[model samples]
Target: MYAVLSVTDKTGIVEFGAGLRKLGASLVATSGTAGLLRDAGMDAAVIGDLSGVPEMMGGRVRAFHPSVFGGLLYRRGNASDEAEAHQHGIPRIDVLACNFKDLVADDGIAGALDSIDIGGPAMLRAAAKNFPSVLPVVDPADYGEVLRALGAAGGEVAAVDPAFRRSLAAKAFGRTCAYDRSIQRILDTTGDRE
Candidate 1:
């Protein structure tokens, strides 16, 4: 199974990606995430290779391709989805580990907020939308649970656990909602309120 790891948090990501890799899952990550994995001597491919798009605007435009979305959005049981994925060379992304930038009051929060990532949220939402086929993880705390599930089910648990899937979808929506709230707060404080 393929796992997409595009997190701004950068907490426990190296260990999480390594664990996923150890379980025979392929890792697709963005710039900083790829760097973190590589720095920890883990094999991680850049998301651009998977999506065919360079991360532009200081890495804000990553993972915004049809390749990315198709992999995350395609239904596993649909023959047409499988055919289209095969035709476009898009692999199914079974797991997505993503966390948005924390909108906290810090020295780098301003610049980081500027690169808070629209595409990442969209990808998370799409993966969450297709949660029955994909497992979306938003919190670092759930890494071990996912690892345990993957271990127990031989990497095929995405199809068997409706409660787990729903929990992931709920987290995905919460992350997006928090992200939007952060942006709104920033706008309000910066006099960009509308």
Candidate 2:
């Protein structure tokens, strides 16, 4: 399994990645997460390197490339999709462990704008959309449940139930929606939904 880990909340990430490695999974990580994984002695493929795109705009453009999205969006088990994935060199993304940047920060103006996340939510939504095939974990707390399920299946995503995957997808979508709403609220001066 190929897992992607990009998170703002770093709690339990190293151990979670280690557990994934134990289950015969490799990690694809963003710059910060890759540094942490390397510190823990785990091998990880950097997102920029995998995408063949240089990190630009002071590291703002990360994981938005086709190499990343194709892995998350492609359908598995479909002969055409599988053949296309192979032709495009998109590795199968089995898991997406992610969290967004904090929406509220006390450091001032720079922090406020930087809090809005673009890439993280996109990855989450895509992975969630392709559930059962891809487990999108937004909260670190659910990592244990996912690890247990994967361990029980000996690391095969197909062994996990469709309903559970659907539930997780719902959670991923809800989280992104809430995050966007918060951003809207901060941007809104009138305080009305419209």
Q: Which candidate is the best by TM-score?
A: 2
RMSD of each: 2.7, 3.0
> 1-194, model 1: which lDDT tens digit per residue?
78999888888888899888988998999878988899899888888888778878777677878888999999997999999999999888988998877464333446546655688789889999998888889999999888887777788746447888888899999989888888776655654322
| Tens-digit per-residue lDDT, 15-113, candidate 2 | 999999999887989999999999999999899878999788887788789889999989889899899999989988899999975464343445556
Candidate 1, position 183, lDDT:
71
Query: What are the lDDT figures for the candidates, one per model?
Result: 0.83, 0.86
Model 1 residue 153 lDDT? 73
Model 2 residue 84 distance off true place after TM-score fit, in angstroms: 1.0
Q: What residue runs in model 1 are displaced by over 4 Å at the alpha carbon?
A: 104-113, 192-194
